[model samples]
Target: MPHPTPSPREIFASGPLTGHVAVPGDKSISHRALMFSALAVGESRVEGLLEGEDVLATAAALRAMGAQIERGADGIWRINGVGVGGLLQPQGALEMGNSGTSTRLLMGLVASHAITAAFTGDASLTKRPMGRVIEPLSRMGAEFTAYPGGRLPLILRGINPAVPIDYTLPVASAQVKSAVLLAGLNTPGITRVIEPIATRDHSERMLRGFGATVTVEDDAAGKIIAITGEAELRPQRIVVPGDPSSAAFLVVAATIVPGSDIVVENVGLNPTRAGIFTALRMMGADITELNPREVGGEPVADLRVRHAHLRAIEVPAELAPSMIDEYPILFVAAAFAEGRTVARGAHELRVKESDRIAAMAAALGACGVRTEEYEDGLCVQGNGGGAIAGGGTVRTHLDHRIAMSMAIAALNARASITLDDASPIATSYPVFFQSLDLLRGETLVPAA
Candidate 1:
């Protein structure tokens, strides 16, 4: 089998970056567009969808389920949905690759159908616990057969006459909630999910945008999200906004290192997903949000960032769910702060592609920042976002965030910081290093 490779490139401090660049579409939204399009009737057209490997897995799975998808001459993505409760038995197992979002969400979609589908993935995806999505989905009458450890290579045997149930989430997982709700789509009543902590609302928001009946209410108990089951999903055009997660590296890179000024255009500023930007602002980052608008039912904005004097603030635990994946880059920003920034309620990091808490602590310390490793989070003392001690080979453990975070860590170090196995960065941000390199080339001397 053939594979892809990410060229190893070294990052260095370049003269103040001053330019604008457009990021690709949001991966989370891209994944949902593909999946929801498959569920909606008729042809669903999507513009600005992400072309990264993870989102592509969703596209592939939809195709396997009998949806006809094509890329238009104008570069727009168009899909012919199979309609809710209209999927046919696929010829082969769904190979989800390395995407946890695709694997878990598909479980829900397959659960309420009168079909049996097998699921498998790459090593990283396989090792992840599927029981979270499995538990809630099972309560909705989905029967799952899996390995003794509850791992992948599992077969999900659907109960077509599925029963809709009200399930309050045990954790703040958008994937789990989405799985149950998707399963409920083929059942007979209202399917309710109560979440104590709000995760990303992309699923709920997009569901409504696609014409599904979804109502969200908040109270003392938490947020109760209800969806009317056994309904029709209307097909509509979707225009995905730029990804903020991909923009985090550039945003932090331009802010911490002196003389760097950049304009990141068309980035998604969805309130639920932009908490990291808020934290950076609290740290005195000279970031300005501009050109705010809406696309595909999500908020979009342009960001201008300049290097500024920095101070650290205690990060609230409640903000964890919004910016969870951006923590590695936050560590990069924290390394440059003037004081200590304490992050807690991050037990979720331990279960990610790598144990991010341990990885960030060990890497930051190797680069001369004082770091205290906690079971769930970390305490990072600052070097004032300036040139600090930098001499270490940080292991990425096949995690893209760790690899990119370490690359940004290079700007402040006295010596180059080497990162191991940056190949996986292509999973989400394929053009990341290239975009950074293009800006660097504009500022530096021609290579001999």
Candidate 2:
């Protein structure tokens, strides 16, 4: 696979953004749809799948493991699965690119199949901690040979007749939770995961959609999810909703850009992932949920956002799991609000593609926004709805969200904002710049 050359891109201050746009499909759902469908007995069809590099990496890995996946000219992806416990060991290493979700979730799928495989990734993905998934999967009898701290470039050998275990999640991570459930698919008995904090439930929902028996129960302790092992998955047509995480940038851009009125259509509003909208509403953003309905078992809505005077407020800690990926851009929204906005209990941001808290703090500070970084979060002082001084360039550190967030911040900037290494944006939202151009009502020619 060829990699796009990293280059600096500039986003200039624009007038009010006005348009109806749809972002790419939900990345989380896209990944699971591909994985689950690949494990089914027959051909599964998926529409509106995110064709970004991250999801493509998952598709490629599955194909390498004997799943027949193809994309038709009609824009639908069809996959012929190898069924449960039928995956063949790949001839070589699986190149996961920039997707931690792909690497972790696929590890779970590979953990009980009696196959040996090596997983490797780019510099950024190599550094992300895999131990979270490793420890739990290891308990299921899978053996791993990894770098120190459970980093990537590792080999995993699955144990036939792997033991099923009931494990409690030490952290609030959907990836870890999904990995355990996926691993349980081939075990002899039930594999249970008790999550102390609720994360995204796409895996449970989609698994059940694919004919897997997954049960979720809630108690004072938290969410208890149990999956039966050696279960057969049924293939079905899936329509993925627009990603709320990808829509966050559009929502925030519309809210902060003066006279802006835009509708983001068909966005997934699963309660687990709508915290960004809730947080923005709490900050007095004028956002309305329209045409509420369901798509592929997940709630979908068209969001209408208008320019409003935003006031900074302390974000609730419990909402962190729901909106973990939105903080970098929420920090951008906070920069345009009045007074100070405080966000905490999001130490997870520290372990994302970049140290988002530190990365956003440094980037915002460079753009003349007052921000204070903390161990868990940040306190941002708003410029009181004034134009932000954004002449400085921001280093993206190969994090897609950071690059896009800074681009949203540039809408209200006093000068053009330059971003270093915007190539990573292709990992999740390949048409992000095109969407920006549409909303801005002009072509944004990147400086060579």
Cα error of candidate 1 at position 354, Å: 1.2
Ten residues in sequence with the least summed lDDT for candidate 1: 439-448
Give the C-alpha miss distance for residue 262 in model 1, angstroms.
0.8
TM-scores of the candidates are 0.95, 0.99
lDDT of 1 by residue, 120-204 (tens): 8876777778898888878878889987677787999888878888888887888888888888888888889999999999999
Q: Sum up the clashes in candidate 1.
A: 2
Model 2 scores what on Cα lDDT?
0.94
Give the Cα error of residue 239 in candidate 2, in Å. Answer: 0.3
Q: How large is the C-alpha RMSD of every model relative to the true structure?
A: 2.3, 1.0
State the TM-score for model 2.
0.99
Q: What is the lDDT of residue 154 in candidate 1?
A: 91
Candidate models: Cα lDDT each: 0.84, 0.94
